[model samples]
Target: MASLQGKVISITGAASGIGLATARLAGERGARLALGDIQAEPLQKVVGELKAQGIDVIGTVLNITSNEDVDNWIAATIKHFGRLDGAANIAGVTTKEAKYPHLAEVSNEEWEFVMSINTTGMFYLLRAQLRLMLPGASIVNASSGTGLFGRPGMAPYSASKHAVIGLTKTAAKEYGPKGIRVNAIAPGPIKTPMLARVYGETKEESKPNEESKPKEDLKPMSTIPLARFGESPEVATLVAFLLSDDSSYITGTTRATVTGLLGPPRFWQPASSRKSTYGYLPAGQELEGEAGSPRLGLTPAQKLAAAEARRLSQAQKRAQGQLHRAGIEAQKQERLRKKRVA
Candidate 1:
């Protein structure tokens, strides 16, 4: 475990889910916490519990969608802690618009609602943290697996998450020189209240008597090799690692907790049948050559074609490298000629 001893870390959405798990873990690891959440009661309850456990902690109720609220929370954190060491931007939302509706059918209201909190609000919080943080400070933003790949009916959420990655990478490059690290995590199907609501699994629906009854199909689990949902603490561990000095060299990257589901299920193949050279074939397509096979399922001729394609790609890269070297030589010669004339 990475030591966060004496580090002052601020966490958004700390009232529940991964943020709550991270706060508990970070506190146990000796970090002083400034937790922010939209839920005032839950946030205070968590803070009081942590305080009882002898964890130095404070809670702020603020709306992430408001720049003023975000700024005030950061200000409060700095005032209490004296200096900010790290921050976790864990606040985000998803709507029923992500239930696989056609892109054209998605309501403008839903789109704006998701973007306001996930993207614009992230911009506000990240901007505030960047302004306050000094060298060696770290920031982790929450993204989702949907961010990396386009999912049906998830236009707004996907677009926002992709933007998060773009922001993380851009900030990493800009702030790397100053020794501030920025990164994002793309999680898949974590068992949080948000996900429970998405699956229509409310507390009433989760009673012991209802446990014997069949529930709605969990489509996301079909794609995951792990065959189960991830726990909040599992993600919290990664967040803690990123915030600590343990991941000092890691920045400008999005670590995925997707349980091996890289993309859509259609793009995946079983591990046993997977071939390095063959690459990914569509689901339900066998690799063996056969008549009337799926388009993605390669035959001998297609395999040969793929090999030829690789050969051509390698040749093109080599030619591009040679041209690049020649261009550098030309620039050097031009500089030498200019020096001689001078």
Candidate 2:
């Protein structure tokens, strides 16, 4: 919680929810804030609230799903604040893939639209911000428990979230050696406008608010050990840590349990360590868990709860496989410590 005084930070999807909470937290920490979103009125309201409280803030009503808008927001941030220190790549979208989609009936337009905003949009903003980021720069991408887990109605959302993990990992590896830390947050359900839009209408008109909402909340929480949805501010707290020096030693990590959404994806432990749990071993060797966990014909819980860890492990294996087959020699570059230890 070091003072963020004079630190310049940018956030997308800042009009509401996680982005707005983050802006508030960042401002309270003395960080200068540059915020972007497609909703002009709410975006301005947030900026107005911050400015009234005497926090230095600039709001740009820009769609993160647009490359031009991404570039413009970056330019606006530097123009208004004079420098960039960190960013929260939080803007996102969902498609029918995550809600009411038929695998064989998915329209091309719907598929492309979701991928563009949720995946490409994040990459666009990060790239734009990186161009002007100062040393020790950090970036946090907003991911979801859904990305790590598969929901019956949310494939696009899950896929997009999965892609975010991939992007953050690659960026962390590429940038950490240059003193930039990149990470992601895979949040569980939060009762944002987005969630209200989905669940609010599902309840019967006669259902009492207290009883219904609690039941609705518990639906997802049943999967979570904590048994609750996280508040937007909760995720904001961790994003702040990743941006600050407090997390200097960490990178390429996607912290997903902030909302107690689900545990890391289930993995296939080495046979030598198997103790006969659904997927556990005798416990002597390090669990090379999701590194090779396959999704083919998985059980229902396995598909949703441990999917992200499975994807991550698959990606890592692919990388290692390429490195071995190519036979290309490469050296690990140092980022923080200058001297290579013997």
Candidate 3:
């Protein structure tokens, strides 16, 4: 087992989804946790469970979107944990895609609210964290696959996620020399409460294959290449890795979980290579899963391999171009020699 023993990890949005799942799993691994959430009841529930399982944890009710709240949250972490070694900024929100209301119709209040929680909020928390972060600490910011590739009608969400990538890279560069690693996770469609809000929150409810429903043709699953959504643990596993030493060599990159939607390489044959993929896994398998059951797109080795491949490909392409040009010139010289002989 990877020993997270004695590590002081702080996570925002500890109430649910990836945040809550991360806290639970990290606790099981023996990490001391400073967990924060807006929802006090649920957050306390998590704390209760962790304590029951003999995990060391401290719970705080924090709103990451607020600057003062963010400041206090960090203060509390350092006061309680003595030093901060890891943090995961995983709080976010989502809403349904609507048509009658053009994006321009979105109120500034709404826009700011979304950005406050998704982008600005994370920035505020991260800045506060970097102050107390020890050398070799890690930070992870949450981006989204929707931001990686535009999703129609989610303008606010896309904007926040894109900015998240910018923040992650900037921090990675700034802290790399200091031994702190920063990275971003661009999660695809996960079956969080958020997804239910985004894709299933319309008044246009439907029956399962019953036909005669007006919006029956508007099933969003058809577009998701894997035909299902991911669970919170799918994102949490990657979160844990980024926080752990397993990914010490990895930084400055935005990793994603395109669970139902495969990568660019599998864009065409979504079904062919995808057979090897466990597209979000079925409920039966998930319920009966053992330790480390979920595998996000790339295993740790595959992630390293892909990174090496990208580096090699760039170098190979450059050399190939140079050699090809030299070969063309040599061929021209041979033709000139033959003509002179003629």
Candidate 1's C-alpha lDDT? 0.80
Q: What stretches of model 3 exceed 4 Å from their correct place? A: 96-102, 201-225, 259-342
Error of 3 at 287 (Å): 30
Q: Of the candidates numbered 2 and 3, which has the greater lDDT value?
A: 3
lDDT string, candidate 1, 41-160, tens digits: 989999999999999999999999999999998988999999999999999986633243446867889898899999999999999999999999999999988788755446788899
Worst 10 residues of 1 by lDDT: 208-217
Write the residue-wise lDDT of candidate 3 on 35-90 in tens digits: 99889999999999999999889999988888898889888888987998898888
Model 3 sits at a Cα RMSD from the real structure of 10.9
Best prediction by lDDT: 1
Clashes of each: 0, 11, 1
Instruction: Rank candidates, lDDT, best first.
Output: 1, 3, 2
Every model's TM-score: 0.75, 0.71, 0.70
lDDT per residue as tens, model 2, 1-342: 756777899988898888888899999998999988899999999999999999989888887778998898899888887888889888776553223343455577777787888898988987887777766988999988777755434556677889999999998887777888889988877767666544544335423234223223323433344556678888888888888888888888988744323333233322333232212112232322233345233334344436868889999999999987666433323422345563
Q: What TM-score does candidate 1 get on C-alpha atoms?
A: 0.75
lDDT score, candidate 2, position 280: 14
The reply for model 1, stretches above 4 Å from the true place, is 96-100, 203-218, 262-264, 268-342
- Model 2 TM-score (2 dp): 0.71
Clash pairs, model 3 backbone: 226-260
